[model samples]
Each structure stands twice: as structure tokens, then as C-alpha cells.
Target: MASEANPRQGRPSMTSAMRSSSFIKEHQQYRPPSKPENHYGIDTVVEDLQASKISSPRQISPFNGVPSAENPPTIVESGVSHELSHPNCTSAPGTKYDKLVATLFYKSTSPRVSNTVHSPVRVPSPTRGQSPKPHPSDSEFPPNMSPSSSIDTFPLEPPASEPEPLDHLYGSHISPMCITSFLHLMSTFPLPPGTADLNSAHRCLKLDATHDYHPTVVELTMSPAPSLDYLSLEDLRKHELIYRFEREWNTDVVLRSDTLWRRYPRLVVFDMDSTLITQEVIDLLAATIQDPPDLGARVADITHRAMLGELEFDGAFRERVKLLKGLPASIFTELRPVLDVTNGVVPLLRALKKLGVKTAVLSGGFLPLTSWLSGELGLDYSHANEVVIDETTGRLTGEVKGRIVGKERKRELLIEIAEKEGIALEQVVAVGDGANDLLMMDAAGLGVAWNAKPRVQMEAGARLNGDSLLDLLYLFGFSDEDIQTLIA
Candidate 1:
């Protein structure tokens, strides 16, 4: 009876333990085996599982259909392994087992996987008979790294771009040596107000090369304010800034209008005496008188004063001519050959002629000298005061026949010539040095003072302090190459 009681009491205890162990084993049997930590994801794990089954099939238990394992089963969390023995599988809480499995799945299959514990993970059920797509190896991770290793993704960003400078450009006249300093000056130089929109796409256009101290045109695309015109802007530059720049830098900054008429003048009128020729013809004639040895000096002084507007041109001119009384007409023939034409006048005229532009010399000097000069220069027109000569003695009679080609006459002549040529006044360019040339300059579209007196330089439309008159081509927007082509 004692043996029976012991067997009966132990039977209930053994039965309860077996039931609990069997339930836990049955639950784990149907669940898929966890993949090795280094595997890519659930897809890779499943494929490997199928491959393993075909290679070495596990024998299933007849009682509960559970596959027999050769080694102990393991739990994986972020490549770390923990063995789950048969005793622990049954003894541990079901929820705890579920939590570990969830974390492993999340680390492997989550889009943005983390290595933290207890994170929920979901393993997707792939379609039946569908071939799993392989994960791209190159883009996702480095070639040296294994696909199963944890990826520390850091999204790449592009670098920022820098803004280009506005006044970093220059013309062909600027030399390579001075480009650095020139760029610095231009960068800091204050541009004309209301002439540029600071916020707009304002930039200087480099038309040609650069030189240290040569004529350079800084081309800028202007967006002037509504109230201002190009003429006004030009005047502003002339009055306010031109002299200062010229005094300091020896650079004549000519801000010209971008007009076809200004760029290409149909008629170019020149002043005689100190302009086309080096010596003033009257002063040269006064030098020939033997009776008055100081007549030449006196005439030159009067000429200088008349040119500066200090003396009345008509009175001063007649006074100088009176001093040349009894001068032989043969002086013209003798002096014509010795006349020195101003520098760059020949090439300038030749270039103008090639472009089919009409050129004229309207002079305050004698008609003979003007006509001689016009013919020598291949000029289209010539007008000047005709000196009365005695046929009997072949000498000057101290009298001018026609109206003196003074300041007003020069302006009138310019207008008349423009009208005769069917050219507008705005298409005529006049170049001279004396104050008498100012009226003519004012009448024309563009007037350039060529190494003139201070008063003339201040009032004329533009001034050239440089050596060559050929540099005037640059002011007209002609590049060095263009001038070469035209001159050639």
C-alpha cells in the first residue's frame, strides 16, 4: 500500500511536468529557425534554410512533428548569440521569448535598423515560388564589408557654391602685370548712382585685354533709373569724376552712349592750326618777317590768348594778320613742304576714309594752308579765311576777304556741312584743342578735346590726354583688332 501511494503521488507530478514541456516544445517546433547574425535579412535566411533542408534533412519526431537538432538552439540579438537549452525553453516566460525574436527581426529586416534591445521587429512572408531579389552590394555598403554586417548609413550632402565678383573684368589695354591691382581698384571703385541695380545680374564685360596705363573702356550693362538718361550719366561722369581720374591716373575715362550714331559718325570735322598741324600757320608766317624780329613771338602769344578765349578771336586774329603785312606770297610755297603733320593724323584719316566717312578741316587759318593741308590729308572738304594778296607785288595786303572762320563760323560751318552731306548733327564728330572749337563741338554728336587747354578740357564732351590721336578709335568702341582690320 505504501509503494502504491508513492507511485500515485509521483505520477501526477511527472504528468504535469511532461504536459508543460511538451506544450513549449510543440510551440517552438513550428516556428522558423533564427538566421545567423551575419546573414543579410529574412529573405536570405529563408533561402539558406531551404537550401539546408535539401542538403541535410532533419528527422521529425513522430509524437509532435518537431525537427531534431544536432547542436543546441541559439537566440541572436545584433550579431550576439545566446544558447537556449531545452530546460530554459520550457522554464522561461513565453512573452520573454517572443520579445527576443521580435528584436532580432527588427535588427535584420527593419528599413532603418537599430541595435537597441526590445525594439519590435517584423519578418515579411515572401510569396510562394517567387525568387527573392538580391540586395545591391555596391551602393548600400563598402565592398570590403560583409553584407550581413551592420550598416552605419550617413546620407551624403553636396557642397555649397560661391558667388562670382562683379568688377573682376577689364579691356585689352590692361596689361597682365597690373591686372591684380586693377582688379582691386575696380572692385572697390564706386560706380555711378542710379546707373546699376545692385541686386540685379550686374557684371562688367571684358571687351579685350588690359594694360596698366592705356585707354580702357569698362563695358557695363546699365539699368539706369527712370529719370536719368545716358547723356545725363555722361555729364555726371565728366563733371564729377573725369578730371580727378585723369589727374591721378593719367587715364581718360570716356563714358560714351551706346548709339550707332555716336559709335559710327558719318562726318568728322577737324580744326586747323594747332590741331591737324604742329605749328600755327599764322605764327609760322610771322616768323618770316625781317623788319620785326619779335613779330613771331608776338603773333604766337596772340594766337595762344585767342585760343584760350581770353582775347576776341576776330580782333586778335586781324591784329596778328596786320603784323604779317608786306609778306611775300612765295612764303606759302616755301612753308608747305616744311609743315609737320600731327602724330597719328595720317593713319587716323586713312582709317576714316576706308570706312567711307567724310572728313573736313574748317580752319581759322588762311585758305591756302587749309586747302594745302586738306589735299595732303585726302580730306573731303576745306574752308578757311582767304587772305587778300596784291597781284602787282605778289604780297599779302593785311586783309582777310571772307568772314573769319571764328568760333561761331566754325559751328555754322559744321551744321552746314552736316546738312549738305545729309548727315544729322548727332552723327558728326568734331575734334579740336582751342576754345574756338567748343561751339563746333557742342553742335556735333561727340566732341573730343585733344590735349587742349584746361578750360577746353573741362567743357568738351570728352578729352584725350594720351599721346596718340589713334587712341580715339578706342573711345568710339573700336577694339584693337577692329582698328587693325580697318587700318590694314
Candidate 2:
């Protein structure tokens, strides 16, 4: 009875053992083995495991369905008996692994392989005692690396050790092939240091070195020469000659000195009609004549022709004076007060006098007009044709005294004035409008064709296109600031 009671007491213990075994078996079916301890000899495998953890996909391994010898997959030592035991377990023939191993062996003499079941293995370094270093061209890594990535990795190892030397020689950082290529390039081109060739090569590389490197490339390619038609010797010489001529012509026309106006001329000779006074004296005189204004038009036509050198001065003067045969000389006295001077004449003449220049009026009109102008303007001298009137009748005299003061006469007078004043010919300045004035203009040092005829404009040295006569002060080296005080 006591023995039967003891059996009952042990029943619970037996039941507990059975339940624990069942639980342990179920856990083993699902759970991975615990990580192994790293002994000194086992450190390489542990390191590989750490490396694999870093490289492996985040999730469980895809080949986990294959059973492994160890409870948890472990890195197997390469060339060990256990490694060959799984020879059939390796990737089949013609697989990516086979190709990879073949490429490694071809590139390296004694390529190492890792036997880790689940860890990624780095293909080993080239054999320790190899003959020649494997060319990167022969490596499978280059083919496997994407074109963009390969290009990025080019210049893997420059032939030279330092970057600065390459920069000094080539003006840019060195390329992987640069040191090897430099000697060859120098041999081919053989340019002197610091020459344009060296500079050009450096500049070309600086601009184009960013390009992708090709494995097959043996040398750097130079850009093609521009398709320009170079000038021949004759063409170049002709162009140079033409350029020189044009430059000289341009220089001649430009102002000799910027301060031309400050150094005013010693003498300033002005044209009377239309230049000094607002209206033409002949035209004014013609307006005073009778017989229906037609005679006035005819006289004006004759005056224009004479002034323009189209008609002889003596002939035009005699013809016009003949038409005025019956007119009284008192007309001049009446016209004197009404004769209009230009806007800036009085001030300009005052400024000229202040500067010690001899100012004179040389006109083709009669003394009746010019005499009044000279007295009114306080001119130093005046020249003009004299009108002859019958002393007794005070009317019908058809003669002009002395030679007609036309173009040639104007030139003669300019010369005479320069000589009389004891001034150099270069010191004289002539200003006028008519074609007749061209002769005087040519004779004088500085000829200003003031609002001149086309013929005069073509012949004169300079023209006064502006409205104010004060601008002539600019030609005499007067500054705008100086003129302000003078004007005031």
C-alpha cells in the first residue's frame, strides 16, 4: 500500500519532465542558435560576422531555407576540409559566383575566397609574390562598375605622389594617368617650359579634364583646330596699311589741344552781313528801294551770286550800285539805328577785346553799312566797298569806288591784316559764310565757316554750328567755368 502511495507522489515529477522536453523541442524548431564566443583563433570569423551584419539586407537572409552545419550559420575557414565538404552546395556552374571567381583569378595570381555561408566575402588581394601588377584594365571590377560610377573612380592612383607638383606643372590637379602621360606628352610635343604651348596644354586640360575616362584610352586628345581662314602676308599687309591711314586721318581731324579756347587767337575777323548783324545789309538796302520790290529781288540775286563767287565781285557791285543810282545816301543814316546785331555779339566782342585780341569787320557791303557797324561795335578796323553818290544831286551816281571786296579781296585783306598787325600768319582767325570767304578761310590759320555756304563748309577748317557765338570762346581755350564769369 505504501509503495502504491510513492508512485502516485512521483507522478507529478514525471509529468513535469515530459512537458519541459516538449517545450524545449518546440523552441529549437523556431529559434536560431546563440552567437558563439570569440576566442583568439575565432576572431576572424567574428569579425566577418560583424562585417556581414553591416553588409546584409535588413531582413532575414533569403537563402536561410538551406540547412547549415552549425546551428547558427558561421564563417567557415577557406581551404579547410569543411569548406570542400559543401562543394556541391556552392552556386551552380555558369552562375554569377562562377563568373566572379573566374574574373578574380584572372585579375590576381592567388585570389582568396571566403567560405562564410551567409556573409559577403571580399575577393582577396592579389598574390603576394606575383610577377607584374595586374592592370586595372584586365580587372572585372571595371566592367562590373557602372559607367557613371567608373568614371567617378577614374584617376584612382596618380603616378606622382604629390598633388602640388602636378598643379604647378599642369595648372590643375593631377589625373591618375597624368604622371605617366606627362613624360610621353613632353617627348611628343617637346615644347620649352613657360611657352604658349605649355600654357595652352594646361588651359586645355583645365577646361576639358572633367570628362569621363575610358579604359581603352591611351592618350589625351586635343581639340580640333578652328576652321578659320588665316590671312595671307599680302592681305595682312594691306589691312595694316589701310588701318594706319584711317588712324592718321582721324587724328588730323581731332582737336590738336583740348584747351583750344583758353588760348584765344590774337586777331578775330568777323563777316559783317548775316555774321555780325542779323540781316544782310544788301538785302536791307534792297528792301528800301522803290519800283515794286522786283528791283530789290534782282539786287538780292546779284548780291547772292557775288557772295557765292558765281558772279565777278566788281560786276555785281557795279550792277547793284547802278540800280541804286537815283536813291539818296540818307537811307544809310535811317537804317543805322535799326541794324540788328546777333544775340551774343556785344558780350563776345567785349570779351575778345578784354583778352587783347584785335577785332575787325571785313564785309562785301558798302561803307555806309560797315562804317555804322564799326562805330557801333567799337571795332578796331573795318573794310568794305565804298558807294559813290553824285555830290551835287545827292542821288544819281552809278559807281562803286575801288575794287569789289569779294572772295580774292577777302584773302588779300586777311594777309594784309596779319602783316600790318606784325602777328604770325598762324595767329590770324577768319570767320565767314559765302564762297567768296573760302579764299580768306584758306589763308588764315584757323578758318571758321560760321553758318557757311556748302562750298565754304567744305573748305573751312572748322564750323560754328551752334547758335551762340560764345562757343568760339571754346576754340580759344576758355572753359565753361571761365566763360560764366566773362559772360557775367
Candidate 3:
């Protein structure tokens, strides 16, 4: 009767019968415990009933309160697929919740349960392709070392949220507020302390203080130590001058005492005619004669020519003296008080004497005049051609007794002084203003042309254009202080 109930119904029923086999078997194998009757709402039953109408071959549910076979509720996996298809059914495999549970339970705790859990197999992370980047603080250390040690071994503390007071960091103690205040003070009023001198508290502050905010600590160990004593004004002046000249000339040539005295001369030879004395002694002598103009010019020309090295010393001397054959010897006595010394000669001679340097008068002019100056200035020596005058007649015979002291004799005299004094040739200094003095100037170690002739200036080692002979002290490394002592 059941098989023959409806042949058309049997066809649909057969397919339903096959599909329901697994569900029915599962239900029978694991029978669900009884639930309360009110658990299944009427609306839920109606919904199941309608679904059965749409689907073929539905049957009665065994338990009314339980979920129907055709319309079971979905149970979504937590943190996995959130879509709800059926309330009573579990979520699909490979969901996020399944992975999380697998990680916490199976992978992490399996070691305790099994001794050979194969090292608790790791699930290759989805983020495995990218390497982890280091933190900013870790950059200080090598890659092989742990970053923790670097943080532990850092010399300075980390920047604080609230800065400390200035006094706390520098004056006395350490605190965040102190450090901040100190940094503020440094930034506002920064000064270099390293340049300060030792023993001076201000200098010590400058040396030890770090006014720079960026790097708070100053290293004073490398700074130079200050001298115990300061230099005097005179020494300071000399140092300054030396520094200036050295910079200007780009040379280390210093004005040293030993160099000056050694390089300069001991004997300064002077020519007495137009050089030492203002007027030409020969012209003055010629004035005493009757034919003053003719004889004076002639003698002047001879003196001039001989001084310029144009004529031989003896020849010029003989020629000039011959013209004065009738001149009175008393003319020298008359002109003795009238002769004038050059502007700077007196002071120069005095200074030279004080310096222990010798002065010599070498002249083609008469000895009478040279001898007077020699005695007045305390000159070491004097050489000149003598005018032979008849004592009773008080007249000149016009003959020079010795060799005329001209350019050759001037040079000869300079050499004689150097040889006689046992001084080095470099220790002889010759000063003259005439062309005739060139040979003597060149003979000495250092030749000075004092307000010299243009020709002499070119040949001399140094030239002094000014009338003040005090400048000559410079040639010997005599500073203003030394000059004061010499003049005094």
C-alpha cells in the first residue's frame, strides 16, 4: 500500500528518500537530547513548512523543538566568516577563526602534550615576504648585537618632557628641569669660554663652560695653558713691530742685536769738507788770499773733481795747493771760529761715542780745520793734507806734505781702521754724502749715505734722507727705549 500510494509521488519520494538517508543515519547514530517544546516558535515551523513546499518530498521532523533537517541554522566561526547561512551549521574550513585557534592551541601548546611535536610546526605567515625594519633607537649599534644593550649603555639620558633648571645641570646638581633651563641660558647668551686664561676665574669659566646648546659638554683638556707672567709694554711693542714687519715682508728676518752690531761697522768714517762741515774749508782758506775769486774757484774745482774720483788724489792736491802759494797761514786762525758743523753731526758724534764706536775725519781739506773738529768731538783719528806755510812770512808755500786724501785715501783709511781695531771688515760702517765717499762706503760691511749725493745713495747699503741721525740707531737694533738711554 505504501509503494502503490502514488506512482508520481514515488518518483519524487525516491530521490528524497536517497538524500534523506545520510541525514537520517546521522540523526539516528547521534541522537540529540530532548529539548523543551516551546523552543521551536510557530513562525519557524511555518518557514520550514513553506521551504518544504518549494522543495520536493518533505517529511515530518522527529523533534519539533530541534532544527529541521531542511532548514538548519548556521553557526558562523568567530573572527572567521561572519556570513550566516544556517543557524545550526558550523563555518567552512580555512577561516580566520580556525587559523587563530590552530595557532594558540595546536601550534603553541602541542609541545607540552607531545615530546616529539616536531618543534611545533610554524604556519608561514601571510606577511613572511617582507623583513622587519629596525626601530630608530636601534640604529646606533651593529646589526649582530641586540639593541637592548645599546640603550642600556648610552652615556646620556634621553630628552625629558620637562626641561630642568640651568643651575641644576651646570651649577650644582642633575635634573631634567635644570638641564632645560641651562640649555635655555646657553642658547640665549652664548659665549666662548675656551679662550680664557688660566688662573683667572673668568678664563676658567670660559675654558670649562659649554655655552653651546647642541653639545653641552666642552673639552678643555686640549686648550693651551696660559703663561704665568705677562710681557712688559716695551717688549710688547717690539713683539708687535716684529709681527707687523714679518707679516708685511712675509719673512722671519728679525732685528736682532747680535746681527745688527755684527753686520754694521764699529768705525764710522766721515769726510770733513762739505760732508762734516757745512762750508768748503778750502774755499774759505782761498778767501784770505788777495785773488779770492780766481784761486777759490780753482781750488773748489780741484777739490770737487778729486772728491768725484775724476782726478788722482795727489795730483788734485798738488794742483790746488800750488795756487795758494802766497796765502797766509793765519787765515786758518781767523776762520777757526767761523767753521760750522753739519746739522746732525754733533748729536751723531756724541751718540757714536756713547755707543763705543770710533769716529775718524778723513779729509782733503786742511788739517788745521780737521784737527779742531777731531779734538772737539773726541774723534779717534784725523787725516788730511797739510798746507806748508812759511812761519815768519805767515804765507802758504803751496805744497802738500803727504798724499792727498781723496777717494783712494778715503777707502784706504776705512781699511786701516778695520785692520787696526782688530774688528771684522763687516764691522766697519762708513757714512758720507759725496760721490768720493762711494769707495769707502763700499769697503765697509754696511755703508750709509746720510743725506747723500744721488750717486752715493745708489752705491750705499742704506740711505738716510732725514737730518735726524737718531735713525741710525735703527741700523743697530736700538729701539726707542735704547735711544732714550743713549741720548740721556
Candidate 4:
């Protein structure tokens, strides 16, 4: 299955997977291997025959080179029942064993055919009670659609094979990695003091501050032998943190995990707009023109609906673009002043860079903003939609030229960027907020929903509801001293 982690598992590379398919094709017209003289002694063959408890092999088999009516060819034994005895059995020459072996050989010996690879129908999953679309990240697609389409939705079941930790694969015990997040009260406001009580006497958690940033980076640790199963323990702890503090602080909860970063050297990717930045670029653009002041509110509403999954993102994007038609391209520069860069963007990114980690931005927002963000923050790569402009008029055309890098495209971009840098998909960490970011998030080694919507918060691997993006630095295992030294 494509979702199988290291889909290339057992095989060496992508080429090997193709060869497996080729091998299946070649075996369609099967041929038996040439039988040679006795390899194993006749006694061995007789022993195997006797084990089957067949009174006489010839009576039911070839039966003097003719099919027997009493015991016909339809008497087939599935491999699950008993594997066919190999033809290599042999014994001493002229012995009773030799006689028995020859008698068995004279009868018909059948070979089993494997039907798994050859079956055309996909067996319905017994557990997938209600059929939901297989998430694009999972690489399961409908008959007509290709894997390239980026429709972001939750997979009925997350593909487990791709991740080692989920399978509890780290030298005998579960990985000792914990997701620690420092919460911020608002997008611009830094994490308030004492909201995250590191000294809490909770049975499932232990807190230790690793940084001196406003909210203070804290490690949310779980015991080696957690009360809950390893797979569900971290998530349960995360929910507990959110439930305890999210309402008091006015931000969405997302968890940042350093253990994952330390364990696997990865390329970290982030989504722009409401994620790395405080404001939505499209809504910001909508607010630029004051001809109808409510235009900003209208566009903002649309953006909110889209992010909340209440409206289709693609169509809503088009509608937003249409509303911004004839807007000057200079808005990009003008908006920079009003663009509220999220707290911790600089420190978090700087820490990653100092750690020799590569970073990129894959945004659903436009490239002009994304490109400028990459330049401003020193990101390694940036991918986003190109807003078509009437160059002659220097105004927006309200059209997206080329491919709109939607959810699936985000996943593809993550792969392309990682591969270009010589990293695998499992060595990538994706951060985002909106529904569209889910595909790439799910595809990444770790997906942190940073102040995301409810849908994303629930589905993402980790959630950091707090506003401070710098807490991400702490989550990646960097102490305040480490970050300051690296940036310095």
C-alpha cells in the first residue's frame, strides 16, 4: 500500500516498487520449475506424505495418468491449511523409502497460486465502517482522481507505517519525546507569566522551563511508563493542557514537540497567514481600500469562513481575489507596514537556522507576500499561488495563474523541498492553522497546528494554542541559551 511507511520498505527504492509490480505481471502466465532427481531422501518425502494422512497418493492424484472421479482436481488445499510438500524429498536407493517416494511422485502434485496481488478489487476494510475519502496524504485516491490532487481531509485512519514512534520503535521502549508549548494570550502579546504552571503536581506531566522568553519555554514531560498507552498518552496530556488553560488565554492550542526534532533530523516547514503572521494577507488586502469600509469586514468574513471549513477554500479564494480586482500591486509593500508579524517568528526561525536546520514556507496565500516573507525571515524555500496581474495597468487581474498550490500541492512542495535538500518525508515537520494545511501537516513527520481552527487542532499531530511562535523553538529542544547563542 502506498501509505505503508517507507512505501519502499523491503524494496531498495522507488524503482524496486515498480519492479514488484512488474514481477506480478510476469507471473500471470506461471511456469513450474523443472523437477530434477531426488534432493531430500525418499524417507523424508514419505514422512511428508504420511503427515498428510493420505492413504494412497495415486488414488486421488494423477491416478495412472488419469483424473480420479472419486477424489477430483477440485480438492485443493489452501496454503493456510497446509503448505504443499516440496518435491525435493529423497532417500537411500532401492530402499522402502525410495519406493514410497516414487509412488508419491507418480501421483499429481499441485502448486498453490497466490491471489492477493492478482485481485483487481480492493477488499472493503471491515473497520472503515463509513467510507470517507482517503486523504491525499495517505496516497489513497478514487478511481478517476490521481494522487496529485490536494483535497485536504482527515484520513479515516492515519497511515501508521510511515512513522516509527507511533509504532513505538526506538530501542525496545517508546520514544521519550514530549511536546512542550508556551502559550500566548493573543497573537501579538507574548505568553503571560504563570499561566503554564510548570510546578503542577499532575500525575501525567512534569514541567521544566528551557527558555527565558515571555511565556517561558517549558518541557511537558511524561513518565516512561505512562498511565495510558504510548500512542494516546501524549495527545491526552495535550488535551488536558488545552482544556485547563485555553479559555483563560484567548488563543488556539497547538503542541510543539522537541523529541521528534531531536530524534529525526528534519526540514521544518510552516504555513503563512494566521500561522506565522498575525493577519490574513487576503483580508489585509481587502482592508486596504476604504471606498466601502465594510469591504474589509466582508473579505475577512469570507476568509474566516474558509479557514473554519464552513466555505470551500478554492472558491472562496477566487471570490476574495475577484473582490480585490483592480487593486494595485503596490499593496504588497504598503501592507508590509500593517502586516502584524506573529510573535516568535524571528526567534523561532533564527533558532532553527542556528541549529543547521533548513526551513521553508508553503502558503495558500499569494507568492508576493510569501516571497517577501521568505526574504524577510531568510527562509530556504517559498511556494504559493501567483496572483495574475495586468502588468500594463499595474493592477490585479483576479486570476491565479498556473497551478494553485492547495493542500495536496503543499504536501508535494514539502516532498520536493525535502528531496532537494536530501531529506525524506519522514524527516519533515509541517506547521499550519487553516483546513487547507491539513494534508501537508498529516504528511509531515510532525504536524503542529499553531493556533489553528477546531478541525485542524483536532486532527494535527500536535496543537500549540498559545500565540507565541517562539515557543516552537523550545518545542524543538532548544534552550533559551542555545537560541540566544545560535542567533548571536
What are the TM-scores, per candidate, against the unseen true structure?
Answer: 0.58, 0.47, 0.45, 0.52
Give candidate 3 regions above 4 Å deviation.
1-264
Residue-level lDDT tens digits of model 1 in 400-473: 88799999999999999999999998889999999989999999988888878877887887777655677667
Can you rank all candidates by TM-score, best first?
A: 1, 4, 2, 3
Better of 1 and 2 by TM-score: 1
Q: Which portions of model 4 show Cα errors greater than 4 Å?
A: 1-217, 220-264
- For this target, which candidate reaches the highest TM-score against the unseen true structure? 1
Instruction: State residue 483's C-alpha deviation in candidate 2, in Å.
Output: 1.4
lDDT of 2 by residue, 39-131 (tens): 322433533355434333475443454545454443445664332223223434564121000000010112223222232334566676865
Q: How high is the CA lDDT of each candidate model?
A: 0.65, 0.56, 0.54, 0.60
lDDT of 3 by residue, 348-438 (tens): 7777888788888887688887898789878999988787878889888988776677777889988987789887777777777777678
What are the per-model numbers of colliding residue pairs?
12, 11, 20, 17
Scanning candidate 4 in windows of ten residues, the lowest lDDT window is 98-107
Ordered by lDDT, highest first, the candidates read: 1, 4, 2, 3
Question: Distance (Å) between predicted and true CA of 295, model 3?
Answer: 3.2
Q: Candidate 1 at 189: error in angstroms?
A: 12
TM-score of 4: 0.52
